[model samples]
Target: MTASTAFGQAAATGTAPAFDAARALALAQETFDIEAAAVLGLKARTGAAFARAVEAMLAVTGRVVVMGMGKSGHIGRKVAATLASTGTAAMFVHPAEASHGDLGMIKPADLVLAISNGGESDEITAILPVLKRLGAPLVAMTGNAQSTLARHADIVLDSGVAKEACPLNLAPTASTTAQLALGDALAVALLDARGFRTEDFARSHPGGALGRKLLTHLRDVMRAGGAVPRVGADTPFTELMREMSAKGLGASAVVDGEGRVLGIFTDGDLRRLVEKGRDLRGLTAREVMHPNPRGVIRDDVLAVEAAELMEKHRINSVLVIDDQGRLCGAVSSNDLMRAKVI
Candidate 1:
């Protein structure tokens, strides 16, 4: 095209709709900034009331009953799930459902966490009287401290925000974001206060891959009984290599005549022996075995723990033993990797 024509086309494109992609991104960034600030402001509010909230949940011998309305209800469900998954016994009860006979689910020993932005949700506040009649403690997470929900609660967790990110300041976007973050803060604090163990977390999440990794034990996945690739210490390296190849564990245990593990030999050792010009066909396992290799008791060992042991010893596998030092099982790094626990 001619230069004049090309310039005219560029000018036409520049004026098209007066739109710039960066302007849309700027608006999104502004929204995120507002929400982030709203959450940050909650840090000061978490001082005393946060501790009280944790104390209340800790005092409970039963489940934590969480309730909210509208947007708050969605956030409440997430908080309850997180609390339950992290060792706190918590469940969500719809505020509307509670009015229709579900109130019976709340025991006297349970703790209640109610959520609302304006703190005047009648359905939620209506349950306060019934909750009190049942003698259950109530913790209200709300933006309005003087609102009915806050006034009726046993403890008020202020989740007040300065202003919403919505241009008209009518939407629940920023406020709801703050509330969810605050709820997470509460759940995490309760989790830490209760000293929740990884195993406990795993128990609540047994179906997920993380649970499988943390809850799986060495005994559960290791080759044991007749599956173990082992050979007597006096056995020829040729025989030991055959067993290792057959089992596909890339290693074998060197044990005494009594079948008690005494050492371990691995593929790495074979490579080194070959490099050193040793005759593998004539050598016995006793000549190439790593004496007194690290091991763990099978009755109380996790596969992740075995992986750590392998890492610390710079080895790939370990012979698991019983209290009597007899061979109970064997494990490898690959097993832990397959379980996604290492």
Candidate 2:
């Protein structure tokens, strides 16, 4: 059968032709190459206009209102989110929705990032006058600089692509890629200008893995009070074993009379004791323990830091001490893993 006939039959019967793996791979690579070239082209275009956009956004007292339609609108939402997460206050406002009532969200002190590849989205252009009336500065990201949206824009960012990756050049493939990359460039520039740090990013993303790693403290995951496997320095070796077993921490802290940790007795220590054939029946915890064991103070140490400390020392657990050098708690690598901060 002819290729067109096969395609038609497949469309009608909901069955595709035998997949050509090589053709599929070639097309995918071509698409990637096209999009990559489009992004590379943007590097040279990053002149005064890009700098002006960043400055405008940085100077704004209010949020950035991102406006677009269809595929551009989808990209706008992501851009707004990136800006918001990276220290710039931003929100996506669909141009169509703005025409009805959402335009109220934009204020005079705010800046508007209008996206339209053709520079002629009716929904976006329809509200340019209203935005002007509100005194909101317009920053246009468009392909056609002479188009209506670009002509009226306070700052024009050229986001034109050589061509779409789509075979027919009908879809918003390369154009959308360029727009997205430009949006990211704006966000990263704003991020650097504001000196946005990982801690600040963690604050904005407390529910994610990065947040958990950076925000969660050692104290938050450490076992304290009765849960911590602690024993007196003079505690019998058998009693130390009981403490370790009872807490299920695989280790026990040998503390002094004042509740200050003096040493640590781990499963490895126990193994060494067995290998040495030491008579544990009458031994004290201090005799078999590793003195001045590695530990951290319960201050502002992050869980990820604690995990790193444990890994560096080749230990599974560490005693958590307070400013006064008293044993406050204990944390294990397992705790960090469980908290998803490792």
Candidate 3:
């Protein structure tokens, strides 16, 4: 058959010849190259406007109010969420909504972050007077410095790009990416200026697992009083089994004469000891203990860090220690997962 006939037959049958992997890869690479070039073009052009925009946001005693339309609105929501979760109190308000009585949400002490790539969004530009009358500082993110929004804004963050990655070059692909990244850059810059800390982030995200791990205290979760499964060093193997079953922590802390932690004897240790076939009835905790178990402090240790220590040592639990190395509490792999730290 002729090559053209074979090609036509394959196309008609919907079972074309082997795909061109090299051509497909080249197309993917070209997209990233063009977009990267666009991002690279955003260099020192980020000048005093960037710094003033951040200062205006920092001076906001109430909240950072984000306004945008269309794709810029979607990107603004993400930026608002990131800023709120980090340190800066912020929220996204659609410009369309602002024009419709939702303008009451904006306070005089608030700072307005307006996003419009073209700097001529009718919906966004239309609301400038409303926000201006409210006495809030306006920070505009725009591609056109000469546009009305940029010219009227108290400060303008230039988000212009050299070209779009779209094949037709009419879509808002590269410009939107640059705008999103620039918005994040602004949020994080303010976060640093505000001296935001991990503890502050935890407070904002308390419902999340990371927040629980970082904020919950060790004393709150550790098994204490009668709940702790403990065995004295002189206890016999028969008594130790009862302790293990009673406590249900998979192991027992072996304490010494002063009720201080000496070592640990776990289920696996019991199995190993039993295999030796010595005298189970007479075996003491001290005799069976595997010495030098890893321990942590009680005061300020993060639950996630405790989980890391457990995984690193390939152990199920660790003894919580104090400045004097006394056992103040205990933690297990179960505690870590329950705290959502692991």
Estimate, for each residue in 228-279, the C-alpha lDDT of model 2 and write its tens digit: 9989988888888999999998999898899988898999999988999978
The candidate that wins on TM-score is: 2
Clashes of each: 0, 0, 0
Who is ahead in lDDT, 1 or 3?
1
Sort every candidate by TM-score, greatest first: 2, 3, 1
Regarding TM-score, does 2 or 3 come out ahead? 2
Which of the two, 1 or 2, has more TM-score?
A: 2
Q: After superposing candidate 1, which stretches have Cα over 4 Å from the reference?
A: 1-20, 126-135, 294-299, 340-342
Clashes of 1: 0
User: Candidate 2: which pairs clash?
Assistant: none
Candidate 3 on 1-342: residue-level lDDT in tens? 533344456667888479767645664666688777666666657878888888888888999888888888998999999989878889999998888988899999999888888999998888888888899999988889999899889998889887776545667878888888888888789889989998998898888877887787766667676777778888987898899899888888888766578888898898887798877777788888877777544535666777777878888887776666666677788876776666
For model 3, what is the error of residue 253's alpha carbon versus the real structure, in angstroms, after optimal superposition?
A: 1.0
In candidate 2, which residue ranges exceed 4 Å CA deviation?
1-18, 295-299
Candidate 2 weakest lDDT stretch, 10 residues = 1-10
Candidate 3 vs. true structure, TM-score:
0.86
Candidate 2, residue 115: how far the Cα is off, in Å: 0.7
Global lDDT scores for all candidate models: 0.84, 0.89, 0.81
